[model samples]
Target: MTFENSLAFAQEQDKLDPLAHYRQQFHHPVINGQQVLYFTGNSLGLQPKSARDYINSELDEWAKWGVEGHFHGKNPWVSYHEILTPASAELVGANESEVVCMNSLTTNLHLLFVSFYQPDGKRFKIISEAKMFPSDRYLLETQVRHHGFDPDEAIIEIAPREGEFLLREQDILAAIEEHKDELALVFFGGVNYFTGQLFDMKTLTEAAHKAGALAGFDLAHAAGNVPLHLHDWNVDFAAWCSYKYLNGSAGNVAGIFVHDRHGNNTDIKRFGGWWGHDKERRFLMENNFQPMTGAEGWQISNAPVMGMAILKASLDIFAEAGMPRLRKKSLKLTAYLEYIFNQVVAMFPDYQLQIITPTEPEKRGCQLSIKLIGSDKKFFEALTQAGVIADFREPDVIRLSPTPLYNSFEDVYRFGETLRNLLSQSHH
Candidate 1:
C-alpha cells in the first residue's frame, strides 16, 4: 500500500491488528511517564511480563529446596535446557535431535568452528562477510591465529561492490569459486547485524559445498526475526543467541543446530565436557566421554537453570502465537515503516534517506538500516532525547526494527512521525 494517506492508514491498520493485544504483554520502558516508541529489538528485546513470574518460580525453588533444587525444582533443573529444544527447533525449522540450547552465540560459534573448520594445507582458508559482528571477527581471527595461520592470508572477506550497501549473491558465489581450492569453511550471518540483509542460506550453502567447503551461519540477528530451515537447506551448522529477537533476557542461553547427516562422523573433534556425555552413563563419572547423539553432543557445561527459565517463558509465548502468524504481521509492519520513510523522503528531495536493508521481504528481516544524509552522532542523540528508541551504527546508519510479537502498527507510525519531526528541527 502507498503512503499518500499513511497517517490515516496507520490508524486503521492498528485497529485491525490481531496481534495488537500482544503489545500489553511487554514491560515497556517509560520516560517521564510516557511510553517510548521502541524499535531496537535487534539489540535487546522488550521484557515479557511472564519473565518475572518465570524467573521468580526458579528463585522460589532455590529458596525452598536449596541444593535439592537441582533435581526437585518445578521444571526439573537436571534437564532444564531440554525444555526449550522442541520450541527452538520448531522456530528454526530443525528436527528435535538437531537442535540444543547451550552457551552464548560467540562461544557456540567457536565450538562449532573447532569441528567444522578443519584446515589442511590444501584447504586452509576461511571466507566470511566483510563486516561481520565485532565478536565474530575476533573469534574468526583468533581461531585462524590459533591454528598457526596468519589472519591476513587465511581470511577472505566478501565485500560489497563500490557504492553498494549490501553484498550481492553472485559476488558471494564467485568468491567461493575463487577460493575453492583453499577455502576450508564458509561463514556468514544469516541476517547481517548492521545492514539487516538476509543472506540466501540455501544458495550459499550449495555453493560452499560444491566448492568443497563447510558452511555455517551466525544467526544472532536472524533467529527469531526470520524463518530458517537449516536441515532442508543443508547448512552444516548454525548458532544464535536468544536475547535479541527471541525476547529471552540479555546474556541468556544460546543454541546450536547440527544436521543429522553428520551424526556418525566420529572423527570430527570437539571440546568435550561431562554434560555432553550420554545420559545413561553420565552418573557413572568414568571420565570417558561418550558424546550424546546429534547437537546435544556439542554441549560443554550444565544448563543455566535461571536463564533457561527466561527462555522457556519466551518460547511458550512463541509457541502460542506461532512463528508463521508472527512473520506474516512482521512483513506488513516493516513494509509499512518503509513506506512511511519513503513518504518522508519524498517531502524533502534534497535529503538523502537510503535504506540499506534489501527491499524484498525475502532478503531482509523486520529491521531497516537507514543512512541519513549530512548527519552525525548528534542527529541520533537528538532522536534518543526525543523518545525514539532506535540504534545508531558507527559512521552514519540508524536501524529501526518493529518487533512483530510486541510492536504495534501505531508504534511504526509513531516512529515515522518522530523521525520526520526530528529531521525537521535538525540544523542540516
Candidate 2:
C-alpha cells in the first residue's frame, strides 16, 4: 500500500474506507468556531453523537419511573451493567461471563490484585515495566507496601536497555525468568502509554505461567485501540478505562477481564457487594456472601447507570463496526501517519524528528509517539493553537493517534501539512 502526501490521495482513501461513515458518528472538538484535527483519541476519544440521547433516555426513565426504573425502565437500572457485557467482551476478545463493566481502571486493578497478587514467603516479588502510567505505578507501589514489602526490593521493573525507547520482548521474557523463583505476579500495560509499544501478551503470559506466576495487564491504551485476546492469551486478569479509544466519556465506568478459569472460582478473595452476590438470592439479604460464578463476582457495588449509558452508546458502535474491521483500517491509517512523519522529516533535513513508537505494525497500535529533539511545550501549544489536538509527554514526545472509527485519511494528511508548516515557521 503506497502512501502519497497529497490531499487527493487521502480523500480517495477516505472515500474507499469501510469505516468512513463512523467519522460522522462522533462530535469532533471545535476551537474558534472551526473543527480541530483530533489526534488524541489515544488519550480521550471523541464523544459519540448518540451519547446525549443515550443519557437522555436514562434521564427520561428516571423522570418517569423514579425508583421503579430499577425494574421497569427501558434498560433496568438494576442490570444496567449487564447491557455492556456482550459488546465490551467482544471489544477485548473475551467471553461475556469473563468480562464485566464496573469501576474505574485503577480501582479494578486494585481489586484484581487482591485476588491475584497474593505474595507469600519467598514468592513476594512482582515483575513489571518501568515508567508505566503514573496511576499504575502508584497502584503497584501501594499494593506492594500494603503487603508489608519494600517496593524497591519486591518490584522488579524491566526497563529499556541504555537509551532505547521501547522494551524488547526478549528482555521482558528474560526478566520474568530471572525472577522466576520469587515472581508471584507479572503485570504490564498492554500498550505503554508513553511509547505506544504493544507487548506480546500471549508470549508474556506463557512465560509468567511457566515461571509459576500470574500475568495481568492494564489495557488503558490497548483495550479498544488494539485487538486483544485476553482469554486466548490466558491472562489471569486485566482492566481498562473506556474513555480513550473505547469512546466512553471522561473518567467513565471501566471494564475488567477475568479468564474463565479465575472467574469461575467462586472462592477467590475479593471485595464484594450485593450486585456481585448470587442474583437469585440478592433480595434474600442473607448474611453470607455467595459470590456470583464469573467476573461479576468481583464487583464492589451496583451499576453507575449514567456512565454505563454513555459507554453503551459507544459499545454499540463497536459491535456494529467489529474489532477485526477496526484493526484492518487502523493498520493502514497508522502506517499512512508514519509515512507522513517520514515525509515531514525528509522535508526538514536540519530538524531532528524521531519517532519513538515501534515501527512494526504488530508491535504498536494507532499511536505514533514523535520525539521532537530540542523542542519544548511551546511547539505543542503552537500545534494546539493551529487546531490540532494531540497529547504531549514531558521531556520531548508528542503522541498522535489517528483512530479508525472517527478519523479519516484526510485528517492525517492535514496534520502532516500542519506539521510541515510548523517546521517551516520554526526554521524561519
Best-fitting candidate, scored by lDDT: 2
> lDDT score of model 2?
0.94
On residues 1-428, what C-alpha lDDT tens digit does candidate 2 reach at each position?
A: 88899999999999999899999999988899989999999999999999999999999999999999999968999899998999999888899999999989999999999999999789989999999999999999999999999999999999999989899889989888889999999999999999999999999999999999999999999988899988988999999999999999999999999999988999988888898999999989998999998899998898999999999999999999999999999999999999998998798899887999999999999999999898788888999999999989988899999999999999999999999999899899
In terms of lDDT, model 1 sits at 0.89
TM-score of each: 0.97, 0.99
Q: In candidate 1, what residue range of length 10 has the lowest lDDT sum?
A: 1-10
Quick one: how many clashes does candidate 1 have? 0
Query: lDDT values of the candidates?
Result: 0.89, 0.94
